[model samples]
Target: MAETILALEGATKRFGGVPAVRAMDLTVERGTITGFLGPNGAGKTTSLRMSLGIILPDEGRARLFGKAPNARTLDRVGFLPEERGIYKKMVAEDAVTFFGRLKGMPAGKARQRAGEMLERVGLGDARKKKIKEMSKGMAQKVQIAAALVHDPEFIILDEPFSGLDPVNQKVLESMIRAENQAGKTILFSTHVMEHAERLCDRIVLIAKGRKVFDGTVNEALGTVPRRVLIETGEGPDAAPVLAAHGAVTDDGMTGEGTHRYTLDLAPGSDAQDALKALVDAGVRLARFEPVRAHLHEAFVHLVESAEREPA
Candidate 1:
């Protein structure tokens, strides 16, 4: 059984009489990576902040480890807020140590951890340099290291990949994966579907401040119809056989002597039947493959469907 760590009960928040988040409820189990996904102005960040207790919600409640979001719970959790802010005048290493101590870490231990982190991020030589001297990527690594200094069991990272280069992005990816492997429950939010798809064990998709989809990537992908690309040595007439099995999207473009078409299956479609029909139609098959759809397609489908509905 999964150990429950973070949860929200009727979590709601507003700004100046405008409802930002509406009774949001979610559970992030311990020792798993949870991805928070949504488009811009979708209240992903606002909901996260309310959950972090950095901003009190106008309504609802957020609990960390069966307790309210308070200093005690805060100490046991690592957070990299969406809004990044740090002291520019302090040396890179010292700044890390200061933040670490604030989270109840011993000064000497925090300093040692800071040194190790700086080294891991390839900034060991720049430890004495002020934050202003470090590049944006280096500063970002500092932010990440600060979050891990106290070895919190739960991590909440909001757009932790923003402004990072591909190399730094990979570095953070490995770190997140490692943390999860070490039994740290993490809830990471990002607009980049590729990272969320590959990194998260399960996804909590949000739209307009409400949960749109909550499940594994496979579950969400299953909600959409599969598009199968079929290439045959026969011809366009094969469409008749393909459609006899399922609806197709081919436009009679079977050549310049080429036989290629597409089939779109309805929900709960049995793709094998369609393949069998094509084979039985005497169309010598050259290539037949299911078009792999990821989180992006499923997300777009849900968001567009929602928009098409009445406001």
Candidate 2:
């Protein structure tokens, strides 16, 4: 069995008599990338803080490496909080080296690793530049380098992708995959689903201070019905054939003499069977493909469903 790196059992926290995170349970396996996902104000940060022992949980337990969080355990962990902070007056390399030293590294070794990490993150040219002199994206990369310089066994990041442009986001994604390949366990929180979809081996979803879903990506997508996009030359005639299998939404006839329809496959309906049925009906198919359910769709559905449930 794989080792459990982090575990939260019935973990709960509140601020000023209001629950920030309620009875949350989560476990991250070693060498896996786990995404702690939820929208803003969904208790993701609260839960993470509790797990890190930054804030004491009001109930239940939070454990790191089979023991309660402490300085020794934390030394083996690297964290990038949701709120970004660095010494604005400090040079980029100095800032990273400082973080490493705080995690108990000697100054010379910390500075050496800082240089290597900066180069890896594409900030080699900016190493001697002050944090205030760098652009937002460049500064963000510096902060990430700081978190990773120590090469901790487990890395936790809270909303690391926020405020980054598409290009920088992709850069960070590559960095994350590199870390995982190095055999470090990673857990990150994000409101954006695309990052989790692409990076997470497992996902934990929370909403309204509670966990709504926790499972593999494929399992989460399985909660919603499957859909297929089909384009055929049979125009209106294609409607009846698709409707016979499942609810069909007309995407309208294209200018190229092709009719498009989106079919929400009914329970027990297979995409292959639907395609075969269309072909059997003599519909000249131009395109037939499954529309895979995305993490965003699954998240929204789960949150909305939880909201509708009785107290």
Q: For residues 1-311, what per-residue lDDT tens digits would candidate 1 score against the true structure?
A: 88789888888887988887778888999889999998888888998887878888787888888888899998999888877676889898998898889998888999998898788777899899998988888888888878887889999999999989998898889989988999889999998888998898899887877777889999988877788888777543678787765677665446565667888886666678888877776777877888888889988887777667653
Per-residue CA lDDT of model 2 for 142-209, tens digit only, reads 99999999999999999998778898899899989999999999999999999999999999998889
For model 1, what is the alpha-carbon lDDT of residue 210? 76
Q: State in Å the error of residue 39, model 2.
A: 1.4
Top of the candidates by lDDT: 2
TM-score of candidate 1 versus the correct structure, residues matched by position: 0.92
- Runs with alpha carbons beyond 4 Å of true place in candidate 2: 232-237, 257-259, 279-287
lDDT, candidates in the order shown: 0.84, 0.92
- Measured on C-alpha atoms, candidate 2 has an lDDT of 0.92
